[model samples]
Target: MEWIIGIGVCAVLVVIFTIVTYNKLVSLKNRFQNAFAQIDVQLTRRYDLIPNLVETAKAYMTHERETLEAVIAARNQASSGLRKAAADPGNPEAMKALAVAEQGLGGMLGRFMALSESYPQLQASENMKQLSEELSSTENRVAFARQAYNDAVMTYNVKREQFPANIVASQFRFTAAALLEIEDQAKRQVPKVSFS
Candidate 1:
């Protein structure tokens, strides 16, 4: 009789433990999903802002038509990549595609900004100024969102990989997610400064 009671208690404890671990994994996954959604919102805002910025600069940047078109094309590609990544944030290939697309868009935007510097009329325009300010603000928001997403991902990954949780994770097929990375060496490099 005592042996039967002991066996039942052990079985109940094991079931409880499994349930707790599974719930924890689910919670962490949800947090990661929420963080990615924030990134998506910021990226969507950026995509919408690009057209206005391009239009504002177009009047004064008539000679730079190719640059303008390149920016638009890059923006479209990034938008598509973002959609794919958001659909499956855990897919490394999709994340890499989005990262590359974003890098290309950044490069194109950098070139457009550099070219605008040579056009005094574009720089002085009120519409351009407003659009530039908005874009800068949106970029900052995107950076913050990315940082938050990365942090959440790191935490979730750590939890998923820890000893007992790892057992549950493997049994449940809780795959790891990819981080948003910058693939551009130029973007990673620090700008050279000269005081002289």
Candidate 2:
């Protein structure tokens, strides 16, 4: 009789433990999704701003048609990649594609900005100034959102890899998510400043 009671108690404890672990994994995964959603919102804002910036610069940048077109193309590709990644944030391939596309878009935008500096009319335009400021603000917000997403992914991954949780994660197929990274070395470098 005592043996039967001991067996029942052990079984109940095991079931309770499993339930708790599963719930924890679900919560962490949901947190990752929420963080990624924030990134998506910022990216969408960026996509919307790109057209206005391009249009404002077009009037003064008639000679830079190729550069403008490249920017638009890159933006379109990045937007598509973003949609795919948002559908499955944990997919390594989707994440890689998005990273690559974003890097290309960043490179194109950087080149366009550098070229814009040579055009005084474009640089001095009120519309251009306002668009530039807005873009800069959106970039900052995107950076913050990416940081938060990466932090959440790190936390969730750590939990998934930890001892008992690892067993549960494997059983439930909780894959680790890839961090959204700036793949361009140029972008990673700190800009030099001169006060003179």
Q: Residue 182: error of model 1 in Å?
A: 2.4
Question: In candidate 1, what are the lDDT values of residues 1-196, reduced to their tens digit?
Answer: 9999999999999889889999998988888788889989999999999999999999999999999999999999999999999999757898889999999999999999999999999999999999899989999998998888888888889988999889989999999988888566776799999999
Cα lDDT, all candidates: 0.91, 0.92
Scanning candidate 2 in windows of ten residues, the lowest lDDT window is 180-189
lDDT top scorer:
2
Error of 1 at 22 (Å): 0.8
TM-score of 2: 0.94
Tell me each candidate's RMSD, in Å, in order: 1.5, 2.0
Residue-level lDDT for 132 in candidate 2: 92
Backbone atom clashes (below 3 Å) for every candidate: 0, 0
Off by over 4 Å in 2: 190-196
